[model samples]
Target: MRSGIHPETRPVVFRDRAADTLFLIRSTAAASKTIVWEDGVTYPLIDVEISSAGHPFCTGTARVVDTAGRIERFQRRYGRPATHRG
Candidate 1:
């Protein structure tokens, strides 16, 4: 509860590139850019590479790699027995 000892907590916008999504929130982080949010007020803008909006799991488009199939193909090409286990 001390004064002048904590970083400034202010409204900020986090933008996700892949999903073209923007969110309004509060943070103590600093940014060099700013943007006007839906509330018609300007706030610091932080550009992020990924967020829940663009995440595969959140979007329900996650892919499961076929490791077993790849191992079988490799064995066939090398004439070796497949030793991979699920």
Candidate 2:
């Protein structure tokens, strides 16, 4: 560990807006907001769009993409170049 070279780390509250969940973890991220935790302690609050709580993969609600269909659509749009046969 080097002094004066690393960002200060503190317990910060990350609020997942999508899932409406809160997570308390130590990080070096900056935040201008504050929030009181369940322990009645105030910490820096950072609002996040998504987290493990709301992610499709973590919740096992992920959908399988149709790559074949996408390829067909792309080919139909731009089309493939013709190759010359000698």
Candidate 3:
């Protein structure tokens, strides 16, 4: 480790506005806002559009794509026969 070369890493809060979720973690990122955590301590608050809190995979609400319909549309437009498999 070198001295005076590494970015400052400390506890920071990542806030997801849409989900209203907050996460406390160590990061070198900077923010202009601050918030008091549950422990009565203030930390830099970084506002993010999405995080694991609201992500489809993490929230278990992922959307399914209409693959069959898309394939049919593609075949019709390109004049290709639809290949069927067992």
Taking all chains together, each candidate's TM-score versus the true structure is 0.78, 0.78, 0.78
Where in model 3 is the C-alpha error above 4 Å? 73-86
Provide the overall lDDT of each model, using Cα atoms, as 2-decimal numbers. Answer: 0.92, 0.97, 0.95
RMSD of each: 4.8, 3.2, 5.6
Tell me the tens digit of each residue's lDDT in model 3 across 2-48.
Answer: 89999989999999988999999999998999999999999999999
Q: Candidate 2, residues 1-86: lDDT per residue as tens digits? A: 87999888999999999999999999999999999999999999999999999999999999999999999999999998688999
Off by over 4 Å in 1: 1-6, 81-86
- Model 1, 1-86: lDDT tens digits are 99999888888899999999999888998999999888899989999999999999999999999999999999888888668898
| lDDT of the structure predicted as candidate 3 | 0.95
Task: List ranges where model 2 is wrong by over 4 Å.
Answer: 69-86
* Better-scoring candidate (TM-score), 2 or 3: 3
lDDT of 3 at 58: 89
The residue pairs that clash in candidate 3, if any, are: none
Q: Which 10-residue span in candidate 3 carries the lowest summed lDDT? A: 74-83
